[model samples]
Target: MRVRHSTNLTRNGLTDWIVQRVSAVILAAYTLFIMAFFMCSVDVTYASWTGLFSNLWVKVFTLLTVFSIVAHAWIGMWTVFTDYVKSTAVRAFLQIGLFVILFFYFFTAVLAVWAV
Candidate 1:
């Protein structure tokens, strides 16, 4: 016997899929900029680091980077949780845990950058 599957995809799922791809592209561009900045700062010093962070453009870029990372990780984690976890309770718990960890790191990075 042969089985057939539905061809239609859920709207939310498709939205999430599109968002993930867009986020990936944004992340790629951001990563390249960060890599270039680091490479150019080979002779790094406290003053040099502070100077980079002190710029308004750099601060805005950092905020965008953090937002993109959080968004990408959230979507990726949600996909993993949905695919692998069979129980609803388990999936919810895992997602909550992931959010907590992500938020903590996000805030920490924000504070560190702001302090610079």
Candidate 2:
């Protein structure tokens, strides 16, 4: 016999899935942009790096990339934990720990990008 889940998908879960897919698409485009930038700038000087980061559009795109990555990671990890971790206490602890680490990493990346 097949069984069904007790709980239906929550709004948060649906939103997360949508965000993850959207971000993945955006990241693919960003990858192409990076490749084109690298190919065009053969010299790879400090000025080239500064010029890329100094642009407002580049900065905004980078920030969106960072946010998307973090959201993707969080949603992916949460799914893993929910699926694989059986113990409630352990799951809760690991979820919180993962979230903290993800937040710190995202924050650091944002700060580094801003500082550039």
* TM-scores, all models, native as reference: 0.79, 0.84
**Alpha-carbon RMSD, candidate 2:** 4.0
Model 2: number of clashes? 0
RMSD of each: 5.7, 4.0
lDDT of 2 by residue, 57-105 (tens): 9988988888888777777877787788777678778878987897898
Which digits, one per residue and each the tens of the lDDT, describe model 1 over residues 1-116? 22111211223667767777877887798789878878988787878878878998888778777877887788787777666776777877887898899899889888877873
Computed on alpha carbons, the lDDT of every model, listed in order, comes to: 0.74, 0.78
Query: What is candidate 2's TM-score against the reference?
Result: 0.84
- Model 1 whole-model lDDT (C-alpha atoms): 0.74
- Candidate 2 stretches greater than 4 Å from native: 1-10
Worst 10 residues of 1 by lDDT: 1-10
Error of 2 at 29 (Å): 1.4
For model 1 the local lDDT of residue 50 reads 84
* Model 1 root-mean-square deviation: 5.7
Lowest lDDT block of 10, candidate 2: 1-10
